[model samples]
Target: MDKLKGKGKEAVGKLTGDRRKESEGKADQAKATAKDKVDEVGDRAKGVTDSLRNDDK
Candidate 1:
């Protein structure tokens, strides 16, 4: 969601020739990508824990 919004901002910035806006949009995209990676790692960790518990049974 945030990634998409950031992409839109980037496109709009490019269309309007706003360097500041483009930089901001790029920053937003980078932040969002980092967040997504964190979330993915967390989810995989949770899955591993669940699998380990199930195997103990």
Candidate 2:
């Protein structure tokens, strides 16, 4: 969702030739990407825990 919003902002900035808005949009995208990576790592950790628990049972 945030990623989509950031892409929209980037598109608008390019259309309007606003350097500041473009920079802001890029920053937003980077933040969103970082959050996604964190979530992916957390999910992988949870999967490993679930697998270990099942093995013990």
Candidate 3:
């Protein structure tokens, strides 16, 4: 969502040659991507935990 916006901004900045905005957008995109990856890992871990618990029962 926000990451997509950042990507769009980055692309626009690249097209316009605005160095500052481009850098900011890149940073935002990186942060968002990192957060998303973390969330995905957390979800996967929870799923595995749940499966193990169910198997034990």
Query: Clashes per prediction?
Result: 0, 0, 0
Q: What would you estimate as the lDDT of candidate 3?
A: 0.92
- Weakest lDDT window of 10 consecutive positions for candidate 3: 1-10
The TM-score obtained by model 3 is: 0.82
Window of ten residues with lowest summed lDDT in model 1: 19-28
Candidates' C-alpha lDDT: 0.92, 0.91, 0.92
Q: If scored against the real structure, what TM-score would every candidate get?
A: 0.88, 0.89, 0.82
TM-score of model 2 (CA atoms): 0.89
Cα miss at 21, model 3 (Å)?
0.3
lDDT of 1 by residue, 1-57 (tens): 888888888988999999888878898999999999999999999999999999999
Q: Where does candidate 3 stray beyond 4 Å?
A: none
| Full candidate order by TM-score, most accurate first | 2, 1, 3
